[model samples]
Target: MDSTEVVVRSVRTVGPDTVALILESPPEFDARPGQFLQVAGEVDGEEIARHYTLSSPGADETFEMTVGIDPDGDLSPWLGEREQGDTLEVAGPFGRSYYEDEPRVVVLAGGPGVGPAVGIAERAMADGGEAVVVYRDDEPAHEDRLRGLEAAGATVLVTDEPLADSDDALDVLSEATGQVFVYGFADFLDDANDALAATGHDPDDAKVENFG
Candidate 1:
């Protein structure tokens, strides 16, 4: 992976236990929606690396990553404490699943998985394609951005319950014909896959990105 030094421009809270890190865009640093960066910084005199999905579309001159801080984790706590002007090493625009010029897309996300799912929806809308984002969270993160996506011709569904329980799940899948993206923890992914199967769509056909 190619490494670049980037200076943190700002760090702001996006939701409870979540933050958006705005960093100076490195030269030629272009990443697709759903791709991640291997970010490294020194913590307690030891270098630690963590992968964070790029939450911003590639159109921006700055790089934005929305991170969910884990209080018990070594890297996340340090990342949450990062301030403006701090320098961190970043590498790769890695990941296979991303937005394309498909006619229709279904993005299913849970919890912090909203980061890349929203990014894909934004890019899809910008490309004049239809995007349906079905997000499951009690306290939805990136509510503002999701609303913006709705205003931009993307369908946004927020459910406080499981995706299978959502009344619109099967209807949404029926309309989705192109690519399907699913992001969440392992169990959430499994549930989503089961939901997809129940809707008569092949679960294996969807691109999945799993988290902890």
Candidate 2:
């Protein structure tokens, strides 16, 4: 991972507990959709690092990362307090589950997992490919971006219901003829795989990024 000092350009609330941090990208910095960065900052006389996925389809000179703050967490609360011009150490354009120019793509995201899923869909659409997102969240994160994706002709299914409990959650998988990407916590990944299997879509065919 290459480390660089990046200045915060802006911060805005995307959800009740989530904030989008727009950081000034180094001239040489570049990352694909679905990749994450390790952000470290000094807090309480100690340095804490946390991984946050890049929340944009692509970037030229700036990028965004949406972070869901855990009130009880050490790093998130500290990060949430960051302001414009604050500097932080950043490393990585890491992670393997990136978007490919497939004929069609299906994104299954749970909760904050929507961050990367939205990016993937955006990139896919930019390449003239089809994308469908089945997003499950009680109180959604990145709602505006999701709506933007919808406006861009990507199909989006939003529901407060859990993906595992919804009978048709995985039905999109059956119709998909290209790649499938699943993003969520471990348990959600497991359930997503099971749902894929139940729908006759090979669970192994799906690229998974587990938050746990």
Candidate 3:
């Protein structure tokens, strides 16, 4: 979709220093899990924009983005403070690493990357597919959603240890069967790819979206 003005439907705290921003979907706006929207707003007489991936499984009347609050950042902190009825500019459902009805999916996520991980996993299960999520975060976000996914039969493994150092996480990866996906910043991506390789998985085959 082109740049369009949308109203905030809600702002919810999903975990420590993290929020789920729900916005009214623009007319005809279609996006899948893992696709991203460039969100923008005016602050201090200047416009700032940031890209956030879909945290909601689908874009219906409203879509959601998970924002990691950063007081020092120009856009994230402002995004965290958004209230219902507030307006922001959103553009494009960008990126190529999106869910495509894959029958089996294994998502490796770190920090705020849990947004897309949970989104894809939910969609997969809803489509009668299988999902496994290996999330690494000290203070994990979307804990409630993670639990719900687990309850629904998806294999969810949450850990504070790096993927390269976590034996359980590696074991899961070694035994997992599915299309692989990876999301996070550069450092996390490095660690995740190393773990994938260590587990006899092909890193080049994984669909990845780097937050950086």
Candidate 4:
């Protein structure tokens, strides 16, 4: 899609230094879980833009992007300060690594990657599918939603330890069956690949979105 303005529907903190920025969906916007939008805003007399993945399960009327506040960064902190009715320029529901109604899914996430993990898992469950999330973050965000997913029968594991060092995470990877997905920074992706290899899962088979 071309660059257009979107209105902020709401903003609230989801976890420590993290905020869920809900925006009114643009007309004809057909973004799926794990896809991303390029959001732009003015900060310090210059326009700054960044790509944020869809954190909401679907883009019907409204959508959400999970922003990790960085006090010293260029854009995220500004995004966190947006209030209801604020407008921001956005474009494209970019990226190919997204959920597509698979019967079963396994998501391996790290840090802000938890956004898409939860989004994809929720969408899968809503479609009568199964989901398993192995997320690694020192301070997990979207805690309430994660717990809700667990209560709804999805297997969720949130840990602070590295995937290569966590026995339980490796065990789950070894036994779980599904269309695997991975989302994180480069280092985390490397660790996830190593963990997948250790568990006899083909790393190349996992649909990965690297947040480099």
TM-score of each: 0.93, 0.94, 0.99, 0.99
Ranking by lDDT: 3, 4, 2, 1
lDDT per residue (tens digit) for residues 107-210 in model 3: 99999999999999999999999999999999999999999999999999999999989999999999998999999999999999999999999999999999
Candidate 1 vs candidate 2, TM-score winner: 2
Model 2, residue 92: C-alpha shift (Å): 0.8
- Tens digits of per-residue lDDT, candidate 2, 9-115, equal 99999988999889888877868888889999899899988888888888688888888899998788888999999988999988888775676888888877888
Off by over 4 Å in 2: none
When 1 and 3 are scored with lDDT, the better candidate is 3
**Per-residue lDDT of model 4, residues 66-159, tens digit only:** 9999899899999989999999999999999999999999999999999999999999999999999999999999999999999999999999
Q: Which TM-score value belongs to model 2?
A: 0.94
Model 1: lDDT equals: 0.84
Candidate 2, residue 32: the lDDT equals: 86
User: Worst ten-residue run, lDDT, model 3?
Assistant: 55-64
Pairing residues by index, what is the TM-score of model 4? 0.99
Note the Cα lDDT for every prediction shown: 0.84, 0.84, 0.95, 0.94
